[model samples]
Target: MPHLIPDTGPQRVITASNFVYTISSGLYLTAGVLYFTQAVHLPAAQVGIGLGIAGFVSLVMGMAVGHLADRHGARGVYAITLVVRALATACFLLVDSFWPFVLAVCAATGAQAAGVAARSPLIRHYGGDRPQEFRAHLRAVTNIGVSLGALLAGWAVQVGTRTAYQLLVVGIAIACAASAAVLVLLPAVMPGPVVDGPRWVALRDRPYLLITALDGIMAIQFKVLTVAVPLWLVEAITAPHWLISGAMLVNTLIVIAFQVRASRTIDSPAAGAGAYRRSGLAFLVSCSLLSLTAGMPPWAAATLLMVAVVIHTIGEMWHSAAGFEVSFALAPQHATGQYLGVFGLGAGLAEALGPSLLISLCITWGRPGWYVVGALFTVTGLIAPLAVRRAEYRQRFRPTHIEALGKAPVA
Candidate 1:
């Protein structure tokens, strides 16, 4: 099969760096906590609390670091974040207690968040005519990298020893270090010229903030397959437990295969908003399908679950594609990093809170709750286009509009 790697050397370099970094993410996400609990013997509650704090830290750091990237050089700032993440990850060996663990986790998480913001400018610069499409390609590559890393982590988990866990952590640390070194191959991106406007323009742009909020709400769908579907399969349906893995496999494969293609048609901010609307409706239909599987027979339940997963994944792809398009296009080029950083806050909050909400509504509340979730997505979708229009109108009518972020005509 043809690949999604960038054709140019520098772009390919970025793709390589991103792939390596995301591999570490997959490894850590899969087994980092296990290392603490199984190897270090920390209590579960402390781990949860520490992770909660780290989540908040990450959100705050993303914007601050992103602003720094806008003022300073993105490549340098990005490398620093990567180095910090590597160091913090390696420091897991020193975490013997609650507070120490919190420090390490927060540092690593914050660096990860900051790194995302810092890298935005680099992506926008090298992404050719359609940076959004390149983002989709990277997303596809990320799926592959993460899946491979997860498999490696799975092997470590299966070994189930303190030394094995230690090795896994060290491996991810090394991976992060390697990724930072790899980043040096790219050409340096100088700081953008600061223009006359609000220093924290992204924060002051009400339309952008509104879009970010809506995106945050829609981001809860990311949890559906991971948290809600597995639980629903166990509690309400008679489908084999193995189907859990099957569902995840299907999602990963679909994303790797189709994420780029899905983003191809979403060429502008307005199109991105329309994509959001379509994605929301797709989520709604998937939720409806999920509700129907509750009382079905085993084979039927399994089939329905797979079907729903396909629909849900389609929605997920669209939502992500829309995010890439709108977030990048609506943002002023001079402050791309800052805008992306601000945009990330919504998803960050969702990551911290989505699981509990899904547990309470989609899982605990049963089938009826599914409808409520669907309706929420639908309503959000219906309103997004309106927001995009308002943002466009305001920008157009302004006496001094930003050329870098000016919206194109929407059909």
Candidate 2:
């Protein structure tokens, strides 16, 4: 088995950074909605609208911030974004009305979006030749840290006081500040050689853009698990209410235990494409099983749900592993941040739009909706290899003039 913890200096720093940042995000995510509705006394609609707008703004600005990271160093951009996040989190304390709350949400979400734009470049820079392995280790550490943070947040929720909410928000800000300090300790990775090409080359890469869109579609699994499953169990199936929590627990445990092992084989573009194919099969089977849960006996429904969760978690692991490999492997070394930023749009859009889309399809349309979702996964997974191959071919056969323009060699 590969080491769960990284042995190299840069890898260790990356792992620590992921752990701390994810922990802080966990604490904030668990408490932010409650704080907005209860302590800040914002109506639920206002809160939703404000956050939705902020999320959209973040998505739109991601590529621009990535260009900044490519010009500056990823490490510096990441650290600056952390500090910005800390300040934005602090602004939550001053929110008394809808407009103020919206501004705070925008600031926090924008900083987070920019930070994400910087993150993958930092990882690719520090991960040496085995970025997938390093990413797997960081993912495992993230699960552990987020789990702990969630448990701690649970205690605060149980306290159920305004002061408790305030404390959680304050803790998130302090954590962000501390994480920024930790990032400063990381050795700087210089930006790649300057490329004099058009600033929006990623936008012009058609094959890569298609691959990114497919990635976004695959990411709908997150919404399926979080939104669709709960609604289906409570409304459509005769299963126990606790089964919702049980399914998530199984997913979390499996990911923590086996994600690194699953990622061990994904070392090249072809291998990454193969992993995506496997993930599609897993998702299809899991969705098919889930569609069978309606009108079943409680015991049988519970069993089916558990089985589906396990299968879905497997797909989740493989998809993540393959995504990291393909994303890094296909990106030009000089424009890593820009490409990654563009790639992130798919995930951002999925998270932004997936809940309503999946919930309507799965819960409202029932089994047929699940079948459609399954087909979507299968098609995206199958087409991913073709997209990767096309991109590779383009890179291999680029015009001599384009090559001479200093396209950084792929890693």
Give the poorly placed runs of model 2, Cα more than 4 Å off. 398-411
Name the candidate that leads on TM-score: 1
Model 2 weakest lDDT span, ten residues long: 402-411
Question: Could you report the Cα RMSD, in angstroms, for every candidate shown?
Answer: 3.4, 2.6
RMSD of 2: 2.6
Q: Each prediction's TM-score against the native?
A: 0.96, 0.94
Task: Tell me the whole-model lDDT of each prediction, alpha carbons only.
Answer: 0.90, 0.83
The true-versus-predicted C-alpha distance at residue 157 of model 1, in Å, is: 0.7
Count of backbone clashes, every candidate in sequence? 0, 0
Error of 2 at 294 (Å): 1.5
